[model samples]
Target: MEKKADQVSVWCIVSMASIPLVMTLGNSMLIPVLPILEDKVGISSFQSSMIITSYSVAAIFLIPVAGYLSDRFGRKKVILPSLILALIGGLIAGFASWKMDDPFTMIIIGRVIQGIGAAGAMPIVLPLVGDLYQDDEEKASSCLGIIETSNTFGKVLSPILGSIFAAFLWFLPFFSISALSLISIVLIFFFVKVPKEKDEPVKFKEFFNNTKKVFKAEGKWLYTVFLNGVLVMLILFSMLFFLSENLEKVHDIKGIKKGFVLAIPLLLLCTASFISGRKIKGDIKTIRLVMLSCLAVMSIAVAFVGFTNKKIILLLAVTSIVGIAIGALLPALDAIITENIEKELRGTVTSFYSSARFIGVAAGPPIMSIVMKNFLNGSYIVAGVLGVILLFIVFKFIKENEIGNQTEKA
Candidate 1:
């Protein structure tokens, strides 16, 4: 029987939710501060973006490995050490910003370490949520939605916090991440408990063979879902970067005002995720419909962002629509992928999906920096075109039964 949200362990929910909240704070918190970092740290536009990219680049490579290790060793063992690594990274960056004459490179290195920690923590939370609920599909879906909402919630908070911190000291955002990570570490260590399972560890050779078999059987729809994830994230982050830079460069809106403006879309996104997660509830048809509809909204809204430069309100209206689209898209992707994969391989499979998403994250800032520098409108054009393409791919390939069968099994 399905359980209500309140019936789930409160501590498990809190601990699970904290993982994404902290991860988002670690990364998205830097968005509003990127422009300031360029001047304070003596870096170019592209170099400043690398502070974000360095973390994602490391995460994109290590995430799958972390997933596999989690499946082998259990989730908490991997998670605790990962939290420590993230704390260490934050400390390194915070110290460099305080003491070093040339701290930019050191900060980037610290971000890379933070990314490694991220690989183990946030991505694992999906499967860990799946593991927590076992056969309780209703609770899993609800909890997954809440977890995703937490991720978006962090985004909602990051810009405002980053702006506030950077206003005082340019490096305060980095230090704040350390404090946040420390809190998550304590919560997870004390509050989160992974339910035990009796499955034996598969040998690497057998594991590869099974993964390959699963891919060969499911790669078409799986690849489409993976690509869709990449496209959505790429568009979202790239546009955020563009918006952040433009607010400062064009509108002279900096500090807290800019942070509030950035938060507008993210707030909408966060609300959408919370509502979508509750409404979707493991239904396959709902997943496809919501994803497609959201992509359509995103495409048109992004295109509009390109055309309207003079009116901040117009930009806010369009970008808010883009936020809603992204907000809905994420939880749907998580539900579909989680439902489709087997329990034993869920971590590994989702890790690869997370890695694909991180590739978009890693690429977004640099691409935005380059495109915005050469032609400001080009970033929106790219976002719109990619959305259209991904929408088409999903419409054609992602089958209802593929999702239905998985949901039925759950």
Candidate 2:
């Protein structure tokens, strides 16, 4: 029986890992193909960009609800339905792009559906991993580390995949994302098997009341840490939006050349995430030190991006620095939150974290684009300043608590 349980645990990790991979791959795959969509769909640039924003906007509204449902029901219940929704969304977008002459409205509708589906997928997966390895901090962190790496890996490869598909057909990327979502659905059905909670079902009104109590119970410092994590995402993505535009428009770089430049930072980010996952250990103070150092490095890198004229090398270096910072920051934040929050409310709190992150992702590009258009000279400076502000919040507000009890092994 013990051996059987261990085997189940291994399967659970693999299944959970797939969630991030599907989300990451699907999200990243579209970055390279935006221009193709513009020409094929006959939409304005703002409309084309909405293809990305629609998903995130939907995520912002749906994630908290999904998170609550997962906690009240079960992870698998939420995940399976979400995967099906993603498939529907993907097919809609692909068909619209392929068969319709006026595809923008259809595509946006599809993206919104995908975003709602995504709300149920990625955010819940983290807490599921927490559920799987409840008792061992190191093991749980390691699991999250793997998930984060897979996420970054998807970002790293998406452009390459997107470029290849765009060469053949612009609509191919949506199909690719749909295929991944389908695969994830199959994996989850076969592999994930967490025992359902035995507690009596809580009504929606009662659930929100419980959530309110949890929010009130958590210390101010914990909430601040959560906000800092959100800010990190916002700053990183905002910079990415600006950097991608700068390389393409200002530097006159396009096609694979632009993709290559954009990829450098992601490569560094991937490397940094892997390294941080392996090296980071111990109390909140240790985590704080690592986070602070990463933030400082990121600040320097963004400042360089603002000041430099040699776009290629500057972009590469800055990306590396920010990548390293973010790589460390994500898992560290996850581990911190998981360790600090009570077990019963973990999913709900994590949902809030996910919502904050989606907010950042949704806001980053448009906000940065506006800044670049209006104050081209000061965009990177703005990003750098925000990074510093995050750093200050972390150092001053975050507290050092002992790591909590780990999730019980299956």
lDDT (0 to 1) per candidate: 0.87, 0.74
In candidate 1, how many Å is residue 304 off? 1.6
**Model 2 lDDT tens row, 157-177:** 776777777778878888888
Q: Which ranges of candidate 2 are over 4 A from the true structure?
A: 1-8, 202-206, 402-410
- Deviation in angstroms for 81 in model 2? 0.5
Error of 2 at 392 (Å): 1.6
In angstroms, how far off is 154's CA in candidate 1? Answer: 0.8
lDDT of 1 by residue, 239-326 (tens): 8888899899889999999999999999999999999998888887888899899988888789878777668889889889999999
Locate the minimum summed-lDDT window of 10 residues in model 2.
Answer: 401-410
Worst 10 residues of 1 by lDDT: 401-410
